[model samples]
Target: MPHSFALQRSSVHSTAFRRLAWGLLVASWACALVSIGLSLARWAAIGHAMDWGRWLPVTVVPAQAMVAGVVAPATMDTAWRWLGVALECIPGLALLYTVLCVHRICRAFLRGEVFGPEVVRGFRGVGWGFLAMFVASLVYQVGVSALLSWLASGQKAGMVVLGVSSFEMSVVVVGLMMLLLAHVLAEGSRLKAESDAFV
Candidate 1:
């Protein structure tokens, strides 16, 4: 009777957790969509205002000199700066995809199919998604920095900062961990099949 009660309790907990995860995912996905829409609108506005009729925002900054001989320009192409802003947001989109994978995993768990191949595959998807996000973020930062610097090459001092952030490194580590978990799940699923065959 105690074991039966414990099993029921655990089932209830899993169900509750699944429901909560679904709600949170829906809310987060809505927010992400809104954010992406707003970003696109802002970029469109900037692009329309460009001097070349290319539609981009413009900003003017005072000239600076890192050394006495090297002078910088007071103005640069700040128009397509919206592109950089948009690029920076790529990770958020990747995370949304990851959330979808997690949602699938949660569904499988709710159905008590936790050790199934589908669950393992979903875990693998999540791991790869995180890894992709990390790579995309790094590319965005470095690429944007380089592009901006090149645009300002004639006047403003070109600056490029290339380094992996701690947060990015952490995400990479998390991705690796997820992949490890997927491997464990694969083994578990294999063992489960073997045991079931005996039964």
Candidate 2:
């Protein structure tokens, strides 16, 4: 495991953790919407003789494929720019779905529905969503690189890189761990049901 996987009790109080989770859920949705809106706006800007020199700050949410500061190439055509935007939105959409799954899990926790079937399903959803996000990220990275390389074909200063990043690998591992945890939760729920039946 690339990360130190520990389920330590939150140093902050449980109430604080709950509050934070709720805040994160809201913020994640807001960011997802903003990312989509920004992509649409950028797509609209493609053919308007927009100034690519003045780099606009892109709002990047966590787990998104595109990090901040990747400026649009001046020589990039409208079609390629649109393609890049579409690819970049893949991770954003994935992250949004993942975050919503996490939010469902958190809501169950707040309701004291731990070890229930719903929570287990929520965990499974999160695990699958995380894996999907990672896969989409790989596609986004490769596609954007290819798009940029094509755009800069006539230029001597163009650069393109293709490699598996450690961050991406870590996310894959985390997804696996989440799936494992989901299995554990399912088993626990089953055992709890059996015990209740005996009582």
Candidate 3:
């Protein structure tokens, strides 16, 4: 197992990994751009066909509580809309940072850095990036809630603008798992190096 990374760089697996990495890199960036574009579009449509909270989170105070077809009226105030946009974009910013880390890892894999310090760092970066997104999402929840409620236009008393989702929890779980995997891989890589040096 210590010699696992001793495989030839030009092997089939390396070729496949490089190709996949390239594909993932392109796809991730494209998706991020598209998502941002859509968010902006939604922001522009705030007062028109869509409610201000359409793109933003509109949910109940407790995540378990369910409200159907609840629409918070469009707040025409520029400051309120801008505040909502800022809150909504926080999670997106964190996601973009996470994708940036993924890009780094993909690049490393493309260069045949199957196991090394660079790869380790890349994994760690992504792991922490996801955790950052998790936190940002929580902030978005509170901020969006306050923004939507402060306007007090057709908003229910107990209604909330933002609430936690399974997706956010999943991201955190995946982030922690990634970190664990990174730690294990780092130790394994270190051991392999030590064994090779001894040999």
Candidate 4:
């Protein structure tokens, strides 16, 4: 009777773990899509004359696919094509990392094992990395606009418009907010670890 009860409990735990994993996967992909969409919208609003061509969809779809299955490539390049590649890879990497962390957390919880402080620290690091990428992209957009405007009309209005676009500001704000949320999650994880250790 006890053996049967233990088996049933184990099955329940496994089901719970699977549910948690699926939830994490969904959330990660949704966040990735929203972030990438906002970025593309900002670029479209700013670089009106530049042809994004295959770059826009290339950047977004690959990142989404990475969330769904494989990890995207991460080769660095300065060319516009390579820039699209890098954009896809950056979010792919971030989503992969987050998924892994969430998986670990779920497994530990299912096993009644305490998650370590490292998990929290990893979350914070990933968040900060995303923030840095957003800032760098924004700066790049501004710089490109400035150069193009200077070449055309000797005025910085293009750069200013690019810098102050609604989408750009939202991206910056959202990135910062995500970073803050990561820090909070990390602290909470650390607290949980400490509490479990005490018990």
Highest TM-score among the candidates is held by which one?
3
Global lDDT of each model?
0.65, 0.68, 0.69, 0.50
Q: What are the per-residue Cα lDDT tens digits for candidate 3 across 1-199? A: 4355445545625667678888999998998888766655554455444245677653222122223223344544676567666765887898798788888888878776667787788788889988998898778666655554544445435345556678889989999988997898799779868987988
TM-score of 1: 0.64
Candidate 1 global CA lDDT score:
0.65
Residues 1-199, model 2: lDDT tens digits: 2132123233223677778767876786787788777756655554345444569634322222234323344454666667667876888778878878887887887665677988898889889888998888778766665555445455444444455778888889989999999999999999879976976
CA shift at 81, candidate 4, in angstroms? 7.2
Go through the candidates in order and give the C-alpha RMSD of each one to the true structure.
Answer: 7.5, 7.9, 5.5, 10.9
Q: Give TM per candidate.
A: 0.64, 0.68, 0.76, 0.41
Clashes of each: 7, 0, 1, 0
**Minimal lDDT window, size 10, model 3:** 59-68
* Model 4: pairs clashing at backbone N, Cα or C within 3 Å: none
TM-score-wise, the better of 2 and 4 is 2
lDDT of 4 at 193: 66
lDDT at position 83, candidate 1: 55
| lDDT score for residue 187 of model 3 | 93
Error of 4 at 85 (Å): 8.1
| Residue-level lDDT tens digits of model 4 in 55-132 | 653432222222333222232223533444445455445545655555555554556443445545544555555555
**Residue 16 shift from truth in candidate 3, angstroms:** 1.8
As a whole number from 0 to 100, the lDDT of residue 135 in candidate 4 is 59
